[model samples]
Target chain A: MNIKNSNIIVLVSSILLVVGFIISIVNTMVLVSPTEHIEGSWKEISWEYEKTESGNTNKKISDAIKTEICKELIIHEAEVWNFLAGGNLELTSNTNNETLSWTMKGRGNILELSHKTNKIEHYNIQILNNDKMVLYFSTDIQAKGIVKMTFEKIKEDSYAQKI
Target chain B: MLRKFSNSRTLKDNIQLGALSAFSAGMVNVTSLIIFFAFTSNVTGHYAILAEEISKGNWYQASVVFAWIFMFFIGNFISNIIIINFNHKNAYAAHSAPLIIEIICLLAVGYYGHFYYRETLSETEIMVGTMLFAMGIQNGLTASISNFSVKTTHLTGLTTDVGILTAMFTKKKYRQNKQLRSKFNVLLAIAAAYLAGGIVAGVIYYEAKFLVFFAVSAVIGFIILYEYYKLKVTKYIRIKRTIKLRKGILETT
Candidate 1:
């Protein structure tokens, strides 16, 4: 290539580099928000009720059932929270096999949860209420898909009821 | 136009240069998907999205992303064919043709991806893929032309070289000239452009979909054509210089 073409090559290459550079910056800043942090084990529960054509359950019934379910789940929230937050605690009743077993690090209201066994991602913990805490997974996929179960703190000595 | 300067190199050398950018493109493309459900030049991001959708029970969305990923691979394959088949027999022509194609493809993809096919591909995916492919093709073209003397597409490797060069410069042992200057400029440009591309994509992805890729395509097109135009100007200058030299010699005789 001549000096002219060489310069052209340089120019073209520079443009590509610049374009890539801009994209890298954009991905970091715009698309991804920094993961949130929290402390302790929290209770998280998600439920989806599809409107089935054959089912007679209407919106009002579903809403009332959901409310009652939340109310009933309130009692076990603290114990669930303790089990989740407490180190080295094993659950014989967690039959779902979805419980992520990972060594968690970080402190109150800002927990950084990670599991070496699961190569997926880290979890951000949040305390939603006195008896419920929330674990925010890396992507929104976790939020939209699965029903998360977590617990919130209630009192010191006496533990809340178990689910 | 042909006799201005002669630097002959083989196809293998060019492939090696293109490989640097292509590999980097793969990494960035995959990472972009990990961070955003987008495909960078690599199809892995789309795969991840497909997996995520399966997990989320969104079969429809998953299928769509899968189709988009398929298109990306098709685009890459087509580009490779064009580069191989339609390229120039001459060294310069061969190199220039690929770059031109890359430039054109990026522009088309950007426009189609942004405006016409807005709903088909997400904002982040287009940005990632376009940038990755553009870099890949740019590296391929430059490498072919310069015989692997230059690489501006990927900076991870270039940055390492720059570090070594900086050390060499600091040692004050080797003299630096236009060649070194060009290398330095390329290094800086790559770094700056990558940074800029990220920032631009981020902003556009927020404001609207497809706009980011559209903008990126325009930039790539301009750069490719600009280089060719610059080459023509250089040819003109060289011819003018030769004429002047001939006149001087004749007058003296």
Candidate 2:
């Protein structure tokens, strides 16, 4: 083998090892971004008004209100959002099946989804982890209010829990 | 823009190189941001994101960011390697090789996004990584060949340099310094070109989509061909002068 080639190979390998080692060590210490945790299958848990002129309420949102809020949005009340690798998000609901593309903006704090119809929507990622995510989006569909949407990561293909 | 190599390159050469390369760099960063929600020209943000991922114990995300940064590193490594190894063999080839590779990378991303992009997370990661690598190669070649006097891919350093020079120009003595003025001009050209490129790209991206990549590649391709044409014309002129000198000497004899 050529000395120059071997030397270069060794250098490259050393750098790669160093990078991998640092990341693995940091992984144990653990601080993941929203983009990574946003992936995989998430079942919609709820849709509620996060902010209102009256006051915050823990009461359940009516089915009529849910439908109204989802009217302008592509996703329905009880869809299973399967966020796969490479920005493809497959949304499956009882009456609808939709495919959309997603990207993280504002340093992974915002999730931007682009539909096949060229409609774009942005949601603020409130909280994201291994199994749960909370998204907040403002809707002017009815009046003006902040809508909070919750999702739980599904372990299997089953959607036992949905909105 | 690419006809000369280290030490011999003039301020004019650096300015031309800086402006054109920075323009492409701007287009690339904006396009990547639009398509992938990423800034490909610089690694500072990626480093932060990598740390954020690692700190969260998200091995998958951490690995992805790490790999992205590594691609950038590898691009720089490969670019410099080509320059060092081939500079003696042929300076133009050495310098131009990295750019050709960059063009190929840009075109690949463009073609893939245009025709086959299903918009998957993995695709975004890979495309952004490839772009970072391409930008890395560009930054490396420009810096190396220009003897580090010109770097056009990122603005942190350029901005800092511009700020310092602007402050220095406050002094009439420094304002009269030719070298300082030339350096300032080059830096300004890079900054302006980068901004203009980003604006043009952002506007056209809405209309062109992935075709913007093809346009960026065309700009880069023009640089190479322009230099090649200049080299040929210079060679022809030199050959003619040598022939004329020989004929004059024979007539005198």
TM-score of 1: 0.42
lDDT of 2 by residue, B55-128 (tens): 87656566767777777878888999999898888778888899999999999999999999865555777788
Give DockQ per model, in order.
Answer: 0.03, 0.19
- For candidate 1, lDDT tens digit of each residue in A59-123? 22233444444343212212233334332222222432224332332111123323335333444
- CA error at residue A46 for candidate 2, angstroms: 7.9
Candidate 1 regions with alpha-carbon error over 4 angstroms:
A1-163, B1-36, B39-92, B116-135, B146-155, B159-185, B204-208
Per candidate, native contacts kept equal: 0.00, 0.10
**DockQ, prediction 1:** 0.03
Predicted structure 1: lDDT: 0.45
